[model samples]
Target: MKLLKSKWNFACLLVSVIWLASVNAVALDARKVEVRGLFKNAAILQVNGQQRMLKVGQTSPEGIKLIAADSKQAEIEIDGKRTVLSLSKKIAATFSEAALGEARIPAGRNGHYFTTGMINNQSVKLLVDTGASSIALNSIVAKQLGIDYLTSPRYVGVATASGTTRGYRVTLREVTVGGITLNNVIAVVTEGEFPRDILLGNTFLSELDMKVESGVLILQAKY
Candidate 1:
């Protein structure tokens, strides 16, 4: 894989972004939050394991200040930059430089790319999807991770190839792929069955810069 910007460029800004293990990883990486659902003036965001209902111009406890919003999308300021986030799309401020550099994913037999990642600290397979809003997996995957979604109030109906389905919205404690580890990542649980590999959606991919060349998918941190 090739570096988009010079390696020296990353070297220059590396000192400012390491998380070094802390609950405050949410603070250090404020962009891990995802715009799950939106409404007029207010929005539902998942920051790590907590869901926040914030209004336009209101900042959450973790420093996510809503900039603008309507039924379709939202604009917010994080880490000193303004970003317009669409419903289900995740917009992050940045990622750790040390834990967020390059990766090369070779094409699979089916012509798609596959890679290994850790979800909520457990190993799993990931299929990169630039189109999905958040990380998506089946209920069976959630059960293996010890998540009980039935009692959780954040259930929603999803449209799938099989038809309309029920799923739960939950926050993942941590998701690490290659060298990057992100906290407060948002994901969906497709109640019973879903695709075999988890869909590594925008919630995680949006934090990086990626390119496809020679059947190899290259990913790099965009801080």
Candidate 2:
């Protein structure tokens, strides 16, 4: 009976030591990272070249949890199946307009200029409208740009194809077409029933030195 009791005690100690070592290993393996607002609910966390999905309310087997604070980036797990969620103050800054798209005037109709690129990470078609006083995005275009039109602040008395209509005025953090990037762009968000997608109005054009000749609009970035 004494020998059996000794064996049992040794086994329990071994198991406890092993469990603690496993926990420590997991802690040491976790990597800190920053998450952008692009990810919601379920996001694949990439750390040290490895990727893992972070589900809300669930801690990684290693014991990490992911919580979203805002559009800015946040810290996340890097390695191992489970880890602890650690917030890092060091996060990647949002992209500037120049960093978002390339610049080049593409072919278009009616002597108007066209540029193709991503707006809010989605493909968009923009028409250069010098006549327009500000950038105008149709209802559909605003949705595509991920602007929460309904909750957006109201700006009354905007003219549209349907005549003067209620609209929302918002500043796009960045607008990039071709190699040009425009920041703090004023965009008019029309009501649900709008006709066009997006019209690049003078709000953007006026910022540049442009000349229209032979059906082509030349734009020069002004200092």
Candidate 3:
């Protein structure tokens, strides 16, 4: 009788352990699913769905790759699944150009002319000038942009290399680059002869998140 009772007790214990393990496994799976959903949402926000066609395919090392069929959409591969994703047009257009290297800003060197990007739907080219105390513009550029330099307060000073220059304290109504824009930017208009057309100075550099890594100057607006 005792032997039979002991055997029954052992069987019940094993069953209980198995049931508890199954419950724990289900809980872990639920957590993983929730995390994946959150990540997808975040990616979607950064890049709109309309611009890209998302597809899945089997690949080496990893089981599958999620690719953007259209160049207008940024291509990303999802490993281990076959799926079709429809994204918003805005996201697709933004990524497609990026993937094609159309909108990429090439790495700039010191004393080189580089595009400052778009501002108020206008493309502005900036010359890298470390010596200028503030962002300086030539009379021609100021006039071309319809900036009334004569109306603003005048500041007379000598430039670092150019002798005896006259400047003005003018606020740029809008300055933009790389899809980023800044309002009321402080700038100086120097009358001195500049080797470059426009000078990108500390005034603009200070307002950006700048880093020089591996001989590349990466600048991003702080806003």
lDDT, candidate 3, 20-96, per-residue tens:
99999876444110000011111111221121111222121222233433332223443333344344554333222
What lDDT, from 0 to 1, does candidate 2 have?
0.56
- Cα lDDT tens digits, model 1, 1-223, are 2585667678666644453344477557855677654555655566775656565777877788888876567788886888887655232212111122554566778988776666765556689888889899998888888876677679788888788899888888888665466788888889767755799999988988888766767787786
Q: For candidate 2, write residues 84-123 as lDDT tens digits.
A: 3322333222221121122235336665676544455444
lDDT assessment of candidate 3: 0.49
Cα lDDT, model 1, residue 178? 55
Pairs in clash, predicted candidate 1: 48-184
Backbone clash total for model 1 is: 1
lDDT of each: 0.71, 0.56, 0.49
How far does residue 26 in candidate 2 sit from its true spot (Å)? 48
TM for every model, in the order presented, reads 0.53, 0.50, 0.48
Highest lDDT among the candidates is held by which one?
1
Q: Which candidate model has the greater TM-score, 1 or 3?
A: 1
